[model samples]
Target: MAIHPPAQEALTPPAPPAPDRLTGRARLVLLVLCAAQFMVSLDFSVLNVALPVLGDDLGLSRSGLQWAITAFALPSGGFLLLFGRIADLYGRRRMFLAGLAVFGAASLLATLAWNPAAFLTGRALQGLGAAVIVPTGMSLLTTTFPEGPLRDRALGISGTLLSLGFTVGMVAGGTLTDTLGWRSTMGLLTVAAVAVLATAPALLTESRTPDRPRLDIPGAATVTGGLLALIYALSTAAEHGFGRGDVQIALVLGVALLIAFAVVESRARTPLVSLPMLRRRTVAFGNLGGLLTFSMMTTVVFVLTLYLQEVLDLSAFGTGLVFGVQGLASVVAGVYAPKVIGRIGARRTLSFSLLGQGLFIAALLGLGADSGVWLATAAVSLASVCHLGAIIAYGLTVTSGVPNEEQGLATGLVTTTQQVGLTVGIPLLGVIATADSSLYDGVRTVVAVAAALLIVAAGVVATGLRTVSSPAGAETSPAAAKPSLAAAESSPAAAKSSPSGD
Candidate 1:
């Protein structure tokens, strides 16, 4: 009161100027980006619950119906790298909007389809759109948020939303297929895609990067073909025997093409994925963990849904209600996982989560046709929580290690690995499930194999992670420390002279 400057004025330096209000426009853009991400992620699981209904309606044979799922997954997984490079060369906003358009159009086509073939065609197109959307979304987010806690929070939300989408899609698909028909499920997808498309223009801004590269046509062809061949072979081997001549040929050709693509990338002026990024232990091992986690999770969903409906004689709605418990658990785990990581460290958290997931998968073997619904629900819920924890931890580890510029590529690789794992896991594990006449016995075998795979993945991550300390414990790079302290001490003139915004 006695001529003292206001306490606020003395403590704070004129607000350091409110760093540009995260403009209303920017918020809208982030919303649209996240919406597209949700749509793509939802599509991955939406069809799982609707598969039987769709097959029956369209008179699809078992193998033929399987292709409907495969058509979407195989293309999306294989084309991720190609699309990531495309987003880098073209504009992320441009690719993202185009993807939404394609996805919406495809969903419309799917809604109108009277035959399995037509529906499969639409699914393939949707996969193409997905291949574009995921990497582009990551690229846009990387450019928008800058690195640090802000980006981590944004990505954490993104990851949580993705998990939520998976849960919602399964439940919604079952409800729609039961009440409104499978076509209505497709129609729902169309609406979501259209909404994202309509909102993109006003909300999203184009990324500013110098020197966009030419499209890598050869790389795209080789990688896409390789992935297609590999997945096709896997699917066929699941249907036929692995020793089939066609399967052998496909495996050989696919491996050779992938090798050729790698060689081409090494020589290309603008490679689809930087070879050095793969050398980083975090990126490589984190992706491996994602692959294993999603692979088993997808298979578990597939098998359990079948068990609930076919063996236990539950209605679609009842099954949804049962599965909803797992969804709730996943949401809680995903929301709280960052805090858990902060306390336990990412490496330990990831290992423990994976181990938990493995035990849950093994526990599922106890559920038989006579098992109580609550028993099944509790096991699945625990597994889902573990799944969420593993995903968030691994995601944090991978994203943190890369430079801001490479986030798109890194995210694309992680998404691709999960997609490929989903595609492969279902058919591979489904084979184990179907090999026996006794349904319960087959499910037990399937769950056992999945549990083993997760355990192996946990071991791989544990071994790989021995070199690095906790996320905050060790600076991955020496340069990371200098910038923050220097920025605090710098004059305005010196701050502006720095290459990167500290």
Candidate 2:
């Protein structure tokens, strides 16, 4: 007879809306960001083929040629964490735009360089610009696409283009140098940077941590110095082995500096990178998987390039063709990897892909002096399929469940693994290949070793990730879901406290 009390469902506020579809504008944003990443990667490889010509024209000594690369690698890998945190404090859009400009100007300098000094300066500046672009671009991507299938797919596409850019650059580098001259290689980067710079400012909205924290100066100096010294040692060792006095000195200095940085972080009010973030099962193991995949896969490419050219008597162009096939395979695998992650979860996908990549790399053990070029090509192509999957899955795994405010730091770690792995892996493994009596034996030994490492890494990642769920499913462990330092420090209560208070 009396009006019934409102139902409990009606008493509660309506449920929050689900994430919307990728808007027309979101697609544009993705295009611009991915373009920037592509340019960074393109520049990295595009210079490889032109190095000899550039050296002759600019009177670069053998040491100068090596410096050309080391100069770039040093800052690109070293400054990533520092710049990432800076972007989190300042505006990401501002940093990103500035990076594009620096990269463009540097490319122009290299294009017109009249001497070795000028060319080296341009290359070094390009690396510094890349350090800014990589993390900022990746952070922009994760913040823009809310976590789920949408984010997974976006990362997949980005991964596809990134790999493609490197491969394309390798091919384009040789062609452009031979046809248009060596300067065209750097000129290509100038054009690509300008294109991305033109579009990015329009689509990207500014994003950063709400509370601006003081920069971590001590943490920055120690980590950046550590990375620079570490990369220098490894890069030098790649050419001269570990016995050099400089390599030994740099190695010791790097280890000591990194240890000091750890001590600094434990005591700092606002650490550059949160120790807890690194400890997260997903973050730690995800990055490990990323490091192994990138290192081994690139090593495989290096070994095959030698085998193709030195052993099989293939020309440079023919070698490029072989890699072109592998690049296509990567594209196909990247396109479908998101769907796989959606089904099995990123953890499983990462582990399985690493395993697959290992098995295919092991197939290269069959390559011989008389072996057909197709054999090496087939092995690399198949391995690349798994490589691309691992790349996408690793990115998804690393960035999953991270808060938007700390996306810059998280992506900084992602990109650090990527750049360091690429830079360090070749040199580390190249030592093994060079140490053996014969080139063929050395390559065989290297592949065997790479396979072992990949398999071991797969086991380790699988075990670490056993209990964790995928971001696609929106499930994660309490430890991974816990607020990171940056997030915690932003809170009113945490502002008055420090890490020891916990």
Best by lDDT: 2
Residues 300-418 of candidate 2: C-alpha lDDT, one tens digit per residue: 88888887888788999899999999999989988899889888888888999999999999999999876758888898999898988999888988888888888999999999999
CA lDDT of each candidate? 0.76, 0.88
TM-score of each model, paired residue for residue: 0.85, 0.94
Highest TM-score, which number? 2
Candidate 1 lDDT, 287-322, residue by residue in tens: 888888888988887888778887889887888887
Q: What is the clash tally of candidate 1?
A: 0
Clashes of each: 0, 0
- Model 1, position 1, has a per-residue lDDT of 50
Extract clashing residue pairs from model 1. none
lDDT of 1 at 388: 80
